[model samples]
Target: MLVGDRGSVSAELVIAIPLVLFMLLAIVQFALWSHATHIAQAAAAQGLAACRAQDGTAADGQASAQQLLDELGRGPLTDTNVSANRTADSASIQITGMASMVIPLLHLPVHAEAAGPVERFVPDLAGGR
Candidate 1:
């Protein structure tokens, strides 16, 4: 009988397999989280842009934000809240939502904000070379 060689490989596998699988799952979860975060930020930015647009009102911005959320997710969105604000020279939007993971029993709460200067430009209609 060997001192430490008997079934050593099996023992190592038993210990290492779960650890490796856990690490892989954690990485996958993190990637999902990061992607959700980006989607949240993008939704907020789209809302803010819509709010700042001259053709649309705040409700339009909110609707756009909701559309963005829908595009980023499968099934229906949960607990979505959206708002936008405008000043004499500035505009901003805030979006809050929760994204459910593809895997059961997993959910990620997302909150984001987007703001930019509100400017109206008038281009010269006259043809110039």
Candidate 2:
């Protein structure tokens, strides 16, 4: 091989390595964002389940969501918030947070919501015979 040919491979590698690393970092970042979204959705479902139970309160739902975040979501979610709303026949839960940052300049948002009918028994409308 000629002296000029010896340096060509080195030059190509030097240019390509950074691009490959960047791609890997981007993939890892996407995975982190996806995982964070799933965690948020699961937390919202847990809260909704609590609120939909008989005699459940909005506070119970909020607490359940927060507890799930505390126990299972440490690195993937930040600035977590949980909210619950309940009506006479239905209940809902919402969760919001920011996904952990893998790149210093990029930010990803995460959100999830769930709803269900409140458990209750209704008497028959027809008059008893």
Candidate 3:
């Protein structure tokens, strides 16, 4: 508690505040990335499910993927979209999203993909005969 030490608190605050703010910004960015990833996964799953249920008349799987992305992506990933395609044996989906931050001038881009074969189950109405 000396007269010459009067500025120590101010100095400490000035340094600590920026550090804390930086960490918070980073955390927000991380959360946004995680949320975007989750939404992408969900979209992929929807696409796969739609492919499995396709009736051979239209490309419902692609529409399902896009719909899921639109519904799940908000906030940092609001401008995201999903792409999907189905081949003879399998279906695949991809997601695109972005995250922006003020500190350090950062804008993060996120992309992910998921794929699986169309599911099928043979009916055993003959009771294992």
Top of the candidates by lDDT:
2
Residue pairs clashing in model 1 are none
Report the candidate with higher TM-score, 2 versus 3. Answer: 2
Q: Across residues 1-129, which tens digit of lDDT does each residue of candidate 1 receive?
A: 788699989999999999998788767766776776778788888888888886656777788887898887443345778887777577788877666565457777878898877767768788664
lDDT of 2 by residue, 14-127 (tens): 999999999998999999999999999999999999998998999999999999999888999888999999999999998999999997888999999999999997788887
Which is the better candidate, 1 or 2, if ranked by TM-score?
Answer: 2
Residue lDDT tens for model 3, 46-118: 7767876545211676788777666667665656766777776777777777754444567777777777776
By TM-score, the best candidate is: 2
- In angstroms, give how far residue 42 of model 3 lies from its true place: 0.6
TM-score of each model, paired residue for residue? 0.73, 0.89, 0.80
Instruction: Give residue 96's error in model 1 in angstroms.
Output: 2.2
Which ranges in model 3 have alpha carbons more than 4 Å from their true place?
A: 54-58, 100-104, 120-128
Positional deviation of 118 in candidate 1, in angstroms? Answer: 3.1
Q: Each candidate: what lDDT? A: 0.76, 0.93, 0.72
Cα miss at 120, model 1 (Å)?
Answer: 4.2
